[model samples]
Target: MKRKKWMSTLLLVLGFVLYFSVNEPESAYAMHIMEGFLPMGWAIFWWVAFIPFFVLGLRALRKITKETPELKIMLGLAGAFTFVLSALKIPSVTGSSSHPTGTGLGAVMFGPLPMSVLGSIVLLFQAVLLAHGGLTTLGANAFSMALAGPVVGYYVYRWMMNASGKQKLAIFTAAALADLSTYVVTSLQLALAFPAEQGGIAASFLKFGGIFAITQIPLAISEGLLTVLIWNWLQSYSTNELALLQRQMKGVKES
Candidate 1:
């Protein structure tokens, strides 16, 4: 009952954010804050911002491992999945491209702890190797994409699954919601970091979220459908692997 309530609240919050984000403006920061949007001092300030959250996530992971061995493997796999998936960019606009973040699927299957850790790793690599994000903005990026995305995704997925008997429908709904929610959270972060004089927080979010929605909504839906298909396929063709994965997670938690 408590979990259900929490999920409901999360969905409501996500929905509200999405509604606002749909009207936000367009900027490179719409997808991610660039290398120099914030000055070095400010960027460094935000970069280290995720330290506390990372520590909390690590502690959560240790607690989770007490009950499951599979958690460690899942974390590793999630990191790998994010790394590989993000490395493959698909053309969005003429010169621009985007990739599936995969934080949603990770959170749904392995909980938010692992997903945060995994996402951080992937983002770090992307920043260093591909210059996809930014070194100074690492903290902001990690918090928005890694921590917030997965946590929201996990709760949303759980909520939808519990509400529906149809597994496929639940998975699809969760995936779409999670993807959309991640973008909304990103917009909120941008709004906070780069406040507008006239519009304030609400105005900033509206500007960034609106433009981001154009690119993100379709991508999110595609990601959601792919995730559902993959999950359903795994359930049917590779229950043994899924069982093993779950068992390993349980062992990681226990250990």
Candidate 2:
């Protein structure tokens, strides 16, 4: 089972790389190439982008597996849920729609490692079926949305939960922060991909950051509230579900 898991991950990574290489563009960044806009540089970028997250994910996995079997199953289910939900898109303006992405919720539930793997799966499916993001951009997109978002959200949520006395308040605050952090990190990724000609990284960041922030702010808030509501409701009515969550969290801690 362990070897099979590793092999499956390897195959997915290789397949992801191959798909991007065949479809990427020369000068354009992969993130900018929505759908059907393939570039070679973008392909190279995707390959380069995988290194850090892959390392982090491996380390995380090593740490995560030291827990109870039931916890592991819960984490797996959370990842699967995130993968499926994120693939469902809602209409937005600017000829592009938006989706929940689910990184924040996944991070809250299972931490970052599993979320990275889950995020990669979600992006892969989005590229292959929905044609939302791109094959070449999958790695970069996953890094930004899955890796960065979850890491940020996890830490932020942990901090809030630890600092606060009230559970509801902590959950609400964490949810909002996580959602906003996801969008901010995603914006940073875009800014890096589409740097301005005149000023440099800072200037490009400001420009792209402003536009992306305006576009994503409302969506982020809505997602945050929705996540909190759903999570709280689940925790309330579903004793088994809450027990499962606690088990997974214990596993994560032990690992």
Candidate 3:
């Protein structure tokens, strides 16, 4: 796809998501950290930590789109998958809602680097247009859902695939763990920012994590199954694209 066309497509998706956010009737506390919720030090730290990966991701994105322009559609699909899945929020314990990170499918398909860019873009626009997450906390949210989730998901798929040669299992585990990893990292972020007086960060992490576990575990599993279905659809319907993708992602193979 042409660069201009890609930008237009992205904007179109952005518009749809904004409309969904604005017209939605129910409001629940966001699982995403709100604006100005984190301390300045922590917020800046996350931004600093997240920037290097995003920079590397930009390079990777450019290389892929320039090299094998066909995957542009696949790229857009991955981003849209994330936007759709993550936009779904279910009420949960505490003040926040639980939802799938939806990074695993893309991470498994395109690897983690490019996904960092896509996932971060999702978080950025959500923060700006939806007010779902805050600009100050975007770094933290992006780090958790984008960088950390995709890394865990991608590697888990690689490891599972290599070890067992089971594609379905690999995809499921990657998606589930990827979904879980976002919440885990987010829990850690909350714990770090607000450590328990008696138990400190570790104690607080367990507490924060415990709160999210109620909803996140089931949501993760559901996301995993849903991703497997999507993977199957692609495998059956887009054989040529999968073949091209296999070539693009070195070391990926069907077992």
lDDT, model 2: 0.61
The per-model lDDT (C-alpha) reads 0.66, 0.61, 0.86
TM-score of each predicted structure versus truth = 0.73, 0.71, 0.88
Q: For model 1, how does the per-residue alpha-carbon lDDT over 82-128 read when each residue is reduced to its tens digit?
A: 67554544444433444557677777777677667777888888888
By lDDT, is 1 or 3 better?
3
Alpha-carbon runs more than 4 Å astray in model 2: 1-43, 55-67, 71-73, 88-97, 247-255
Tens digit of lDDT per residue, candidate 2, span 1-255? 656655654565455335334433333322223653435675467658766776777676666666434456556656765564455444433434444555677777777777777777777776787665787766667767777777877777777777875655555555555556655666666556667788866787776556445535665665565566556545655558568666767666786
Q: On TM-score, who's better, 1 or 3?
A: 3
